[model samples]
Target: MTSPGLPDLHRHLDGSLRPSTLARLAREAGIALPVQPRFTPGMGLDQALACFSLTLSVLKSPDAVRLVASQIAEDALAEGVTTLELRFAPQLHGGAPPAVIVDAALEGLAGRGGLILCGLYGEPPDLLSRLVAIAADRPGVVGLDLAGGPLPSHDFSMSDYEHPFAAAREAGLGCTVHAGEGRPPAEIRVAVELLGARRIGHGTTLLEDPEVVALLRHEEITVEACITSNWHVGAIADPMDHPAARWLDQGVRVTFCSDNTLLSATTAAREHELAAALPGMTPALWNRAVECGHQARFTRS
Candidate 1:
């Protein structure tokens, strides 16, 4: 049977642009890409990450943010995506405050041809309350997330950010944290137990602990699995070996995403296609993944 349509639950708006779009933007603004475009296709995780950071250098203004956001929405529409949750750190734009960046993003989506739900990414321990306040203030903002580099030094421990995450919960904002991607299983546990995360972004390491896996299944927490990102990061030796299929087989809710589409040179459709190459995955299972995304989405008035 033909695969059902794809829905991207976890994508960074800044990371979802087509390479041609990035090149055009760079040219229009007289900004140079950090790495040559040719290097992006086969670049490793660190290199890909560097490329994304370079893109951010050019995206340091409100007009750039608006342009990227609009392009992301248009790209999603072209992909036949019915719904997509785009995440980004609002503070990435230099001069403007986080709120203004978010407002500019919303403005970018105003006349877009399709519906796209946007969420703001926050680093824990420092900006959780500010992130929550943005969600509370913006009707278009749907959820809260923790996104940053994947390293022990970059990890946001719950011990450091519990109170702020609690504040977000009190504000009725839905929570999702990037855990278990490159960190230990204990970090994943903290996200669920301490941070009260309803969804775990890149919870690949959870498979190491059956109890943790069971808890995730029992709690009905969704895992946003970015296949290409995992492969690029060396988290999994190969895209074909990623444990997303195993997690799904064990009844864990796993949704596919393009963590940094430009860096990874992929899309939600491409992710699902790669997933299908894994053992035990079928079109039916892929549809279930989409359902998991819809279920995991933060819905509040």
Candidate 2:
């Protein structure tokens, strides 16, 4: 099938660093890549997360970062993705100020899509506050994403994101959280009830719990469902195992996304193709997913 012309709402800036560009940037910076980063099936989330260490080398310079953003935007445009929400934690880009990296990325995505700046969980509280302020000030920043992995421990006493989420809400920035992908379904409820997440990044585990699925429908939260990345991130054993189609059937709002184009060597077209192969795949369901994505996209309005 051809590209679905759907909006990709969960692509990550660091994850979209093209292999060719990575090689060029690494050669220019004298940094070496680690074993060609693609999602080897069965790779755990920790392993997948470690791949970004190599990408960080390429992202050290403003020009390199800008190049990545521009290339990703152009790639999305070519693949019929008109709306995008490229995300990345700015502090991870080798000590470059968050604002500068975000600015460069915004310039690359000029007139293309709005940015969703991420603040990784357990990040320094001061830096988190600074990122919220920066996101509030940046022209194309439409959301503040609380992104990180390993889910909260079972005891779940960390309050690191509370103040930041409150501040983001106060500033009128949309909130999305990385939860229920590698974590329990309860995390999704925590994100919505406590963290003010209107969208759940991944949320693969959500189908296992009907209550959470109902909560998702009740709260009107959107899920950024990335089929290929699920294999990479250890969220599912196979792309066929993705619950996006199921989520849609359950009346849960969902949109197909290429979680990491470069990292997964996949595209929005590829993601749509995967979604179309799901058990209940139908033209009507596909159209609904596309419309859900369009409505949920973070426009800098």
Candidate 3:
């Protein structure tokens, strides 16, 4: 909230859990962490991801989930994010029901934002159905998103396109997909055309296919670009090589985000700063990207 304007759309709840809370929960859960104490600071992509296991270890019970969910909203509000789509995989939380996380997030959010139930790439159809049910029942739950590890667990096949995404849409749930990160640009096409992805995560490779770019722009799809997280995950070797600038130049809708603030140790202000530095990026273009997030958010009410 200090510098970046009042709305950051793409933030992960699990990734933004507070350090002090994690330490306390770890102590209670008897989970050992790295010597550094802080979950952030110079970690390889796998290591940063492994930190989630530690977070998941502690965020099992409803009280734990509620506290962490509330804290995440507090941090986002502090970052000037009046509204955001906080995504997390409830199934990853030691069998905690999706309702617990969603309701807790709603309580914490206090109507400030919405929750996006994450369907991890390898999950079975039944799980996504349950997620869709939860989202459909909860008005504060905004949508469904397909996310996976550095490598996508499921290919962009018909089965992948159908299951949760189509089912969720059929049940009135919004859709977004994590594509163009570990997969090819064509997969981004599949996500949009087949799976109904209104937004894309880490869409750095989207420009690899001109046709895909046209489809994205023509559809007015929003790309959530996480510059630091992309470099940390090695999706892009250099932040300077990021296509956000080019996408903006082409009048493509793009939004900057801190994919995992807990792991990346970044804030909306920091993300805006990094986004402004993209080679050939202009201040006007970057401002438009911020506005894109503000305008593209899925607020059902």
Candidate 4:
């Protein structure tokens, strides 16, 4: 049965693989997966990351990219997703240029009959020019995102990288950053004031600073709220206590997302379910949250 509301706007293409698919790929490539951990009842972050790394390691060719992207689209279709904006850090997939990776992934989405928006992930300073150039060339590519684990020690304030953010704006590509996922709210501020981010990914820490919250609300910056992902990554201790719900209540434009479905063992529908189960959550509020996602979609032009 398909869920009524499943507009998955913030999913990682590499992170949406089914466990069985991952296993098949591992076996096919002769890659040894690390021992699965029992952190939760039926899921383990270590095992998931290991599988993802192995999959990326084996998926070094364009054919593998096509296969994986096709599988992702097929899975989304089965889940009743009418619109899916799949994000992936092409730089993570070695041995191919970003364009080749994106093109192969888009090829897989062919005949799916859904809106598919592509994005560039991570903070690759040197690849900024190439990324902007590619986005300029590809109409399917809608946005540029700074994702992955926080590079705390890396200098993110460089002007060269900021130029691409500006370039994306000029090129009509939506700009977003994975700020305040595990970092401080100041990072979120920099993403807006310094880098000109149109959307903030996992801005869970926004509630910590009232000024930052006000700024986000004032700017109408949409926060891509990934509840399960934040919980799994220790950004929040529990889904019930997640600040995203509070952000929504306070007029902050927050939208639900599945940041890394495979890693979090979640889907967009599951995210909605979790939000519904949260304390003080109501059906009306849940619907409003989902609607917010539709408006905040990167594919909305």
Candidate 5:
């Protein structure tokens, strides 16, 4: 298990819905999921992402959103996670209004931590601006995140998100970007330089570029590492190849996280164990990694 004091800084609430809850919500909403919304080993990233679409279909109401968010917090607490930031894109939930969705999630968390509103890579600038506006106004919202997957579908450049991210920073909102999961290492630099990211989500390939690693250390940026999720998404073929240990040894801060608990079929306890087993990940470095999560948290209590 993770230390009871550890914080998961990079979870996606939308993708972490429990299987039983999903079935009940889908049944009540009269929505039929094409595939089971659970992750299995060996599934590619595309397939895992597709499961999120199925999860979103049933989360069309504020009540549904609230229930899922609240339960995720409860589960995290039950698993000994003292702090967690659950991220989700309000724009993707077609049923409820953005503010309503934000409120529902905040209500759900009930002060366990806070939400990190996401702006997807392919979304329009105006939409991103609106998301930033929501983050600015809501104290329950702790940060702004650049999330979404399958790089081929997103045609926009990193600079396209610069304005909204800058606005987020101006509003005192912490900024994080989902980069270097499957994209080239260069995009991670773009995320930091252009988007003003203070944290990086799924920086799986960060060790590939020494310069980028140095920049992360110089900038004091935290890297959110999701070990189980990386393997499920084929980001790393073998768990031993993960860069978490190397990053720590090289001075880049890393916080182990469960990116999508249900979608990755993992929990904080499981993630902690997996990270602890990685090559070169000593007990001291593992402990420091957990400490880094608390340091990197956007929601300061």
Candidate 6:
């Protein structure tokens, strides 16, 4: 079971849609369900994102997004996740204005969890700025995230995001960025120093640089580690080799998460189990990791 009070701070709502939900929504919309993206071991970044695209194809309307959001929350609660931050890119949902998408998702969340609005990589600056604006003053909106795969330019610098993220911070929203997943490890430093991220999503390459790890520990930045998803997406060669436990031992806060529950076919509980099985994980360390997760939550008292 997911440790009670342990928070999942890095879930992607769009990628967590249930197969049954997808089928029902497809039928209701008179849209055929696209071919399921088969998960090959180590399918790599391009193919992993392709899976999310398939799920997005079914979510054509805010109502559809709302339904999926509610169901995903229920599923998380069922799995014993006491707190969650379910994130999604509103701009990817459809032509509906971002506010509409945010409202639909917030309604579905129903106070069961907080929402993190995502600004996808490669999205136009104007669209990203609008997304940041939409997050402000929204009830149930606790955080803002920079997510998605690498842009064609392979640029993951903070230059394009600094202004909007500053606006996000000004609005009192917590900031978390998807850095070091497949990007250069230096980008993780940029995220914390420039973008003002308090948490990092899928920091797969974090341990590659000792300086970066030290910076995170010094700043109390949490790393959202998705073990199974990392292995499946080729971010890590093997789940056992993941450095989640090592990070904890090194004094960095770490949290286990199921990045895309449906896409990775895992759960919050399973992620915890994987973390526990890592080489340096002790019972005390495991408990501390759980405590760190609750500490890292963006929701305010």
Best by TM-score: 5
Greater lDDT among 4 and 5 belongs to 5
Off by over 4 Å in 1: 1-4, 37-48, 111-124, 150-156
TM-score of each: 0.88, 0.94, 0.91, 0.87, 0.95, 0.94
Residue 207 lDDT in model 3?
A: 80
CA lDDT, every model vs. true structure: 0.73, 0.83, 0.78, 0.70, 0.86, 0.84
Query: Candidate 6 on 169-283: residue-level lDDT in tens?
Result: 8888889998888667888998899999999988888888999999999999999999988898788889998988888999999989988888888889889988989998999
Worst 10 residues of 2 by lDDT: 150-159
Worst 10-residue lDDT window, candidate 4: 36-45
Model 2 Cα RMSD, Å? 2.4
Off by over 4 Å in 4: 1-4, 36-52, 111-124, 155-160
Q: What lDDT does model 6 reach? A: 0.84
lDDT value for model 5: 0.86
Tens digits of per-residue lDDT for model 4 on 1-301? 7545566768877777667766777777787768422123223333334445655776666777677778877777676666667777666677687778778876876745222332333345757656767767777777877765443465544333577777777887777887887668998998898778878888878888999999998999888888887777667777777776678788888778776667667777788788888876667767777777777766524
Error of 5 at 271 (Å): 0.5
Residues 1-301, candidate 1, lDDT per residue (tens digit)? 8634567778887677677877877787798775644223334545655655667766777887888888787777677665677777777667488888888887777644222222223244556677677767676776777665444564544566787678777777677888887667887888889988888888778888998999899999999999888777767777788888789889999888877677677877788788888888877787788888766767654
lDDT of 5 by residue, 1-301 (tens): 6345778888898789888999899999998866667766557767877777888888988899999999999999887788799999988887878988999999999988779999887787678889988777688899998887536577676788889998888888899999998667888999999999999998888878889999999999999999888877788887667889989998899999998987877888778888899999999999899899888888522
TM-score of model 1 relative to the true fold? Answer: 0.88
- Cα RMSD of all models vs. native, in order, equals 3.3, 2.4, 2.8, 3.6, 2.0, 2.1
lDDT per residue, candidate 3, 1-301, as tens digits? 4654655667887778888888888888887876422333334455666767767778887778778777878788788776577888888876466677667767777777777888876667678778888888688887888886435445434355476788778766678888888457987888899889889988778888999999999999999898888877777877677889999898789988887788778887788888888898998998899889888787654
TM-score of model 4 relative to the true fold? 0.87
Per-residue lDDT tens digits for candidate 2, residues 1-301, read 8754778999999989778888888888887665787778778887888888888877886788888899999999888897788888888886578788888889888868878888876666667688889988776888988776744442223266778888888877888888887678998988899888889999989988899999999988999888888888788988898878778988999899998888899998889898999878788888898988888877544
Window of ten residues with lowest summed lDDT in model 5? 148-157
Winner by TM-score between candidate 6 and candidate 3: 6
Would you list the rank order by lDDT, best first?
5, 6, 2, 3, 1, 4
